[model samples]
Target: MHKRTKSNIAVMLVLALCLSAILAGCGHEPDKPKPTKNVVLISVCSVRADHMSCYGYRRQTTPRLAEFARQCVVYDNAFTQWPKTTPAFCAIMSAKYAHNNGVLRATHGPRLADEHVTLAEVMADAGYQTAAFLSSPALAAHSNIAQGFQNVDEVFVGPRRAVLPTIRAIEWLRKRDPKKPFFIWAHYNNAHYPYRASGIPNPDMFVEDQFYDASRHVRALKDPRAHLKADVPRDHPCVMEILRPDIGAIHTWAVLDERPEELDFYIARYDAGIYSADASIGRLLDELRTLGLLDNTIVALVGDHGESLGDHNYYFEHGRFPYDATAHVPLMIRQPRGAGARHVSTQVAAFDLAPTLLEMTGLTPPEDWDARSLGRLDKDTPGDNLVFTEAGYQLDYMLAVHDSEWKLIDVPNALDRQMMRHQEYELYRWRDDPGETRELSAAHPDQVARLAAILDEWAAPWRAEVYANWTRNQTTIPTETSRQLESLGYVGSNSSEDEEGDDGGD
Candidate 1:
């Protein structure tokens, strides 16, 4: 009987051991690997945030984009670091301000310095198939914006249309390995200057030929050698007849006495361009959906810089100043897996895009980058960080510092006597006066002094870096590229002495 009891006890111990092994098995399972994601970044040239319906603009200038915004995170107060193509893009790709990237002027410096690590390089390092399709000569391969990109297409030089780049991107997407992740940076230039009224067909209202002719004449006046001339004074009946009726008295560089109606016509043409560009973006999005890539890809649409469009006496261009008209741009991001739609009111800068993108893709940004990741933003978050902007060539420099509420524009005394004669410092409460119509520097001396001091401190490092690496020698642009740029009203001369005039701003 004792022997039988011992055998029963051993059996009970074996059963208990089996139960423990089963519990251990149930408690844990192997982790599944995370799915790889693709990233597509589209940078539209000369897009103003306020012009889109999504931003509360009355016009249906961007119906497609409005719809797209419904599925992405739309930043309401996104501003560019610089209001020019090359410099702005340098900021976007390098995650550094233009001043730090050493590409302050459009044509003044060599391509973005080799030291600055680019977004493409980071993606490539992480095994991404990187490609870029650029629509502007200002971002040509020689410009070094193509660094670390496996496939770079700068062939689309004239007219700044979006169709060709979209097609190229589609082809590249198809050719890429399906198993590996990819990154594409496509730039669209349709919303750029020299508005083509002809592109928009059968609009609700048509601009008269006289107004179009006048625009051409005004552009010709910028050329010192053009045969065309405005024989009549700007206020003469001949010019006034084409001016819009609603346009009140306003200052403009095109002509001193432009009619409100004429300005409206010009604006209408710009809106048409925006509509066309928005449609192109819609097509690209549709293609992604068709390929079943939309669900797994992170798509970001941003404007390199905003167009002035006759704001603050700056007409039909950018880069002359750091006003909201030129600095504020549209920034929208659609995350993978339907992250849902949200609007961020916090002020964000263009340089922040690169770092934000890296973080979204589960990658780490370089510690030295000036841009901070925007991934932490949420509905309850408040923006208290200051954003800085700078643009100039040679002796003429304009710097702006702003937060959500206040903005300060500082134009230092330069060799150009005319610019010096104007207000050296202009302060505005941006929230109260979005148009920046009034200068409050005289009214609030303390505020101006405070903001100016902050701007100076923030800019000290960039200023010192740019000065140390300054190169006076001109970059040798390809002949074809120069011709294309000149045709687009970018550069006036090929001579190195004329580099300052190249101001490939918008």
Candidate 2:
């Protein structure tokens, strides 16, 4: 061959080798037996799963989250182990059920035991900067909640909202090392109570924001006499409130805007909070993109639990009773682009979150974790299993076990609903009767027995031993994971309570 021809042939050979190397690189997964250097866990506190547009709420409280969900795996039947904050997170952070952790209500959340392992500690041990910006007051000071963070930022953001945390986190992200990997827990609590009523501007129509600022009125508080459980006088405050004609107030539905008006106001305010949250999130995402950290990161967004807006007589709150309005929630998962995204509407519980995060970050949870990793679940693979959840009789006492198809609620020795009516219950077939208008314990005896047995068994092995202790003592100090109790005005000077656990034993 001529000299020029030989040179050309050499060039082709080199090009072919280069192409091969790139192809191999593309096929290779991240270093196994080793942690991926970059991942983040951001929790939106007090934001119910159902309140977001992604979860079928009428108002668009979470446009960004909804969009983000498209890029991630969204779980339909996700549920929080415990409804309230401390215990719910105790289960999530430790990957254990409330029963095992001996956590029931707000005060129940003590410092996690030093033996317990957290995703933060896992990432931190694997050489990631494990930091937490506890935005929610629910997990703030005087609690053992910040057990596993190098940056235990329990900074008091005003109103337990996202304003301060958002600002602080953005600043921290900007200052942190780009090459050093990190595990950040950015929590927001703007969606809880007070509903951002003032700045809502328009209760009927408003941007996604935190807390509505609309004025409360009497006319809108009134409902039908039949709707009122008690024989409230015709001129009672609730009756009179619903009859008001004030167009300025958020109380629009004179008929008691359960889902339509009041719920609308609630959603609008949630959006405002989410608006601020989304702005913060967008800023963080932008920073990642600017730092070129976008593609290398894995982000998972989820609710600790859900909220209720008069689905079954429980209005504007949760954990009041065993109802789907407060249990069913949205769970989102987004890996890098080439990683592919699949929507798994199958029955996956939020308890599955810990193991899933661990597995996604290339870490396996301990054998004791009842939760399962989504990394183990195929995209279209049917997760044909019933999820089990229970709350050790704490702030509110009820035994519950549910599947995608149905749920059974047992409110033993309960009658005073609304802090007035007290009664006990053995209810079943909640899926068919969402309002729980019918109690079918007598009808589906076998199902009730099976479900009740599961709840008992789960609570017995994991919870009974510890709960028996709490039931007996009922101390001023809550069960280890009791932030919610503290938030609710439990001002016992028990600084001697157990601290939040930060076990990083490898």
Q: Name the candidate that leads on lDDT.
A: 1
Q: Per-residue lDDT of 155-260 in model 2, one digit per residue for the tens?
A: 4324434455556666777788776777777776555544542222343346324344445222243322212234434532123222222222222221323433
* Model 2 residue 340 CA deviation in Å: 3.1
The C-alpha lDDT values of all candidates are 0.69, 0.56
Cα misplacement distance, residue 149 of candidate 2 (Å): 1.4
Candidate 1 C-alpha error for residue 127, in Å: 0.7
Residues 1-506 of candidate 1 have per-residue lDDT tens digits of 99999999999989977877776689943332332789999888888888887788777778888888888989888888888888899888998876667676554334787778999999998889999988767788657878889998864543434466777888888888998999998887766644442224533233453324334322213322332122334432112212211112221222212333356665766666677677777778888888999888999988878877656655676665788988888998999865967998788887788888888888888887988887756533464668788864433367888877889988773421233237778898987888888878889999899898988888776665554454532366677766555443334432212222221323
Residue 376 displacement (Å), model 1: 3.4
TM-scores for candidates 1 onward, in order: 0.79, 0.72
Off by over 4 Å in 1: 1-35, 158-160, 197-223, 226-261, 378-381, 394-396, 414-421, 464-474, 488-506
Q: Count the backbone clashes (under 3 Å) in each candidate.
A: 5, 59
